[model samples]
Target: MNATDRTPADLLGSALARDPAHPLVTFYDDATGERVELSVATFANWVAKTANLLQDDLGAEPGDRLALLLPAHWQTAVWLLACSATGVVADVGGDAARADLVVAGPDALDAARPCGGERVALALRPLGGRFPQPPEGFLDYAVEVPGQGDRFAPYAPVDPDAAALAVPAGSAGGPEELSGARVVERARADAAARGLAPGARVLSTLGYGDWAGLSAGLYAPLAAGASVVLCRNSAALAPEELARRVASEQVTHTAA
Candidate 1:
């Protein structure tokens, strides 16, 4: 990370400033045989639009807690940075009832129903398609996000020391919470451990259910000015297919 990047959003901005056209996050759904790649500018646009939707449409404010029940898709990565931009604590797999807002995947809708706050759902489609039927008490994120402003300006400044993330107790790894500064610190450390350098292409098959997964699959590569190749349901891929993917994506590092 650069000297000025104390938060994930700042790290993203630095990446954007360095190379807006460079590919940032490339996502694959092994089960669906789908792939989507977003350049730095494209990813920033998505993050900005999502942040606007959270702040302007959903009325999210600094310190608000958002329960994010999503997977390792590109949209989930977008939501992470969006929450950072808006100062909303990203509670991954958190308690829905206590959230100020909830963003759930298709499988997570039922679990998110208890949230009294504004709720949104992602179809996790190949091209970000909307659900044929919106779940009860939830907005369609794909439909709502595209209409939001292209740029985001937070209503209030985020406190780097304030709580920024919560990894709920889970089977993967968990029951941990962190401040914004700590999140950045951890990401930086993970990048170093992963031996990620600028321009590195790191492939990760980690989920988004815990801090370890988030650090390896999203924050670490992003913090290092490297790009990510995030694969969901990767275990379903045959060995040959996985090898082909690594070769085709020009993967320089691997995190499983």
Candidate 2:
């Protein structure tokens, strides 16, 4: 892969071709006692299905905004890449009302109701199960995604210069947009600044709300050809427990 290739989809493709069976994303939910590990191939599979759902099922075209009302989990990582692959702009934590599609978790149901476009809900259960009783206005992601094609092809090729992310300002500013190339550029720089060596396994307990967090938690690792061990409900863990996880999971770098 060329060093200048900056699209998230291109980063993933490089990773898959370099090491298909290597761990890509390892997720842990301390509150739920859930742990899932996805290799590069497995991660790519999930991204493909979700991308197909976005492109084909939801009619998401290039530049379409999809509000990702989700937390830091394995599937959320999948959705980010899926959006890149399908040329959709992932608006993480953005308002659903302004989006073309909304993919929400249980906590965001009420907030996502006003979204007039397509809505998909993730139960976030162990093994990615569907809700016992489906939410009234949202399609269950687990139920719908499995039926999508395993392979994904965007309606049109993604332009590296096109907007790929919409990040709301944390302080006193308007929302910031990042092009596909910029996303990759930022990730690589952030990874190097954080001293993430090549193929490092990084553990992070951060939300994907801003550029820094998103870069550290997902894109940076991909840019470095590293893997991520994403931990949610991190408040439930003691300092010693976190250290134990770092050792057990073979985490070489950490972004707290």
Candidate 3:
């Protein structure tokens, strides 16, 4: 475990410095036959750009809530880190009416409109393609992110004790909120529980609607300094096809 890493952003920074060329995340969509891999450096770049978009353009400050209306896609993972870097609390599947900002995919646009704050939409297309027809009353993320700076420096240091992530109270007792430090701690715990080590590759087929899925699909591998094969729509894949992916991606561990 990394004693110095107190937050998700810290873990990402450590990973970026340890090995920038190593693959950090490999994403797939079984139905679309799409696969994309991102190195640590590349993923960091995306995080930086998205952070800038949140901070500079949207004027989002620390403690502000962002209702994230997306699924378990690679871009959603990027948004998670970006929120941590900026000290913005990401409310996964949260109530848009209570948010200061909103980011949604094409399918979630209808659910995002209640937020009066600045709204952003992601196409979630292959290779990060822009929406062919822009949605009204929203900024297109793919079109805006390229113009952002490659490096990010938050105006203020993030507070580890402050809330970072809030999951909707689905079938649970109440909403679950975690501080930055707790997020890192849980990720590390999950990573160790799954027997991940540095450079280990993990395959996960979990959605991002709750803490369990987030831990397995993204944060755990990242905290372990390992990599992930993040699969979207895994239910569509045949059993043989799933086996093929495990062999092809060289997955050493699995969390599902």
lDDT of each: 0.91, 0.90, 0.93
Winner on TM-score (1 vs 3): 3
lDDT of 2: 0.90
Which residue pairs clash in candidate 3? none
Q: Report residue 178 deviation for candidate 1 (angstroms).
A: 1.1
Local error of candidate 2 at 33, Å?
0.7
Better of 2 and 3 by lDDT: 3
What number of backbone clashes does candidate 3 have, counting pairs of residues 3 or more apart or in separate chains?
A: 0
Model 1 alpha-carbon drift over 4 Å, by segment: 169-174
Best by lDDT: 3
Predicted candidate 3: what Cα RMSD to the true structure?
1.0
My TM-score estimates for the predictions, one after another, are: 0.97, 0.97, 0.98
lDDT by residue for model 3 over 113-151, one digit each (tens)?
999999999999999999998899999999999999999
Q: Per-residue lDDT for 158-252 in model 1, tens only? A: 88888888986666664577888888998988898888999999999999887778988899999899999999998978889889999999999
Worst 10 residues of 2 by lDDT: 1-10
